[model samples]
Target: MTDVFAGVRLLGPPETDGEYIALSEHETVHLHEYTRIYAVPGLYEHVVQERLRCTSPQVAAAGFLRAAATLGLEPDSMTVLDVGAGTGLVGELVRHGGVGRVVGVDALAAARAASLRDRPGVYAGYVVGDFLHADELREALRPYALGGLVSAGAFGGTHATPQALRNALAVLSSGAPVAFTIDERWMDASDPDGFGAAVEQLVADGRLDVLERTRFQHRVTTTGEPVFYQLVVGRTG
Candidate 1:
């Protein structure tokens, strides 16, 4: 197979993400450039998965299974929701992990398109709407009986907020398995409105019961520097 990354160049370190690939010799894009990145077929997979060696997808999928096992629950009848659902990478992983059904939710329509193009049939259904405030989105997802939630590289930074997490949990069945990964910097920050505080508040309020929290290298930066993120496993109250 030919190397797709051969045409790409490293621009430098991204602020928080572990990727920093250039479109051309002189044109670099931030990770937030989703439209540009997702527009190109195989670009995201090559840059983020192959080149950067991202592992959050696998980690989050495995974490979900671990959470289920810890809860003495089986996946035979569970339906999982993959938040972010970019290109269906995480969704595909969870599906192969034995989750009977996996629905995807992403705010970007382009993401949904890319997933269909690159990884068709991975998601039982893909919904594009805001998890935080889309009133109609809740109804749209209700048919899936969202009993489990899993995500990787879809929280923190310019991605899903902690409130989004809460809103998602609100619709899930009680004691639904939940697993996700967030950058360590975002997970440890003391900002009152940050994920750290939000999660603390969730656990304190008995909304989310955390089961396991561990840190690992999510991926490597353009300069080959390790970037760490925390995998959080829990269940809704």
Candidate 2:
């Protein structure tokens, strides 16, 4: 698999609309073909984490820990919810940061299966359902009394919607720390449906209080092109 992955070359520009990777001596696949990627163990880690040099998992975990500290919350006293918890990388990081328990949520069942297979016991529970529309999801998660919400590389594009984010926040305890990363471009207030504008609405409505927001390289494309994202750390009102 290493050799197979090593032979891959990412197609240009890392455009959000579409991206491709030509596998060395193998085949090309759409970058977002998560179902295929997650099916094979270590493939996602090799491609996205090691090959692409993605940094969102580390950034999100660190940001969440710092935010939790700022809010005077003890990790052992709370259970954190990880949105778009792909393969449990962020969940493992948060756990290593002393978080007593972490729960993972993703729309794809493959993601849940991969997480359990690749990184066992990292998440106290992993929910496979739509964050916005799954009636069973919210009720299933409500029992945990989620204290913090954290995500990595899960927003923007066709991923989690702002409405989904709102629903997650509603389940959190007031003042629970929120940490996530999204493409910097999506944070723009100019795009009404974008996270940037959505965040403004959240702030204005007193639903969120941002503490730290910074831009950092999320990862590089197969062509060594840098992709940046905004690490947003805040607390719910």
Candidate 3:
């Protein structure tokens, strides 16, 4: 059987740092353009997962599960807040990992719509609001008593900013597990985004405790070059 997105074409290389393409009957868009991509069922998976082989969701979930296990936390008893939960991919994986409840947060309505269409019932609750400024969402999530935060492939580029991470942490209970994956370059000292510095300062200030850090292939670029990402699992202090 022919794939739904078999006609989609991606162009660009790892050096470009992002992929761009015009799918059949669609406008040209970048690979990280979640709103547009999610509007079309199977397109995001075909481009990012099937073609590029992105495994960030699995990597982040594995690290979180392992950390939770080491901390004597039962996955089936934990409620996790999935930041930047594009199309509910990470939420689905985390839920399957036995998390009792999964809440998804993203800035795009298209993402929420897509998640409902593609992975219905995966997230106990899905919020369509920016993590940085969505006070209502923060309040809505309060009822969930989130015990952990998990984000995959949503920290770098035009996705969630460092401040978004802080906002996400604010909603979780103290000492909750936090896990995420980002391009290694985002953590470089030279990167102007200051994500690395922000995280380091959080640790230095005793606000977060580092548990595990692993580097792995996040995916391959359209040019077939490997893109490396770092998975970080920690606990809010």
Q: Go through the candidates in order and give each one's C-alpha lDDT.
A: 0.86, 0.88, 0.83
What's the CA RMSD of model 1 in angstroms?
2.2
Candidate 1 segments exceeding 4 Å error = 14-20
Identify the superior model by TM-score, candidate 2 or candidate 3: 2
Task: Give a tens-digit lDDT track for model 2, residues 78-125.
Answer: 899999998999999999899999999999999999999999999999
Candidate 2 matches the true fold with a TM-score of 0.93
Model 3 is weakest, by summed lDDT over 10 consecutive residues, at: 1-10
For candidate 1, the 10 contiguous residues with the lowest summed lDDT are 11-20
Backbone clashes for every candidate come to: 0, 1, 0
**lDDT over C-alpha atoms for residue 63 of model 1:** 98
Q: What is candidate 3's lDDT per residue for 89-201, written digit by digit as tens?
A: 88988888899999898888999999999999999898888876858778878678889999997776677788877777778777888899988888875654667877887
In candidate 1, residue 56 scores what lDDT? 96
Q: Candidates' TM-scores?
A: 0.92, 0.93, 0.92
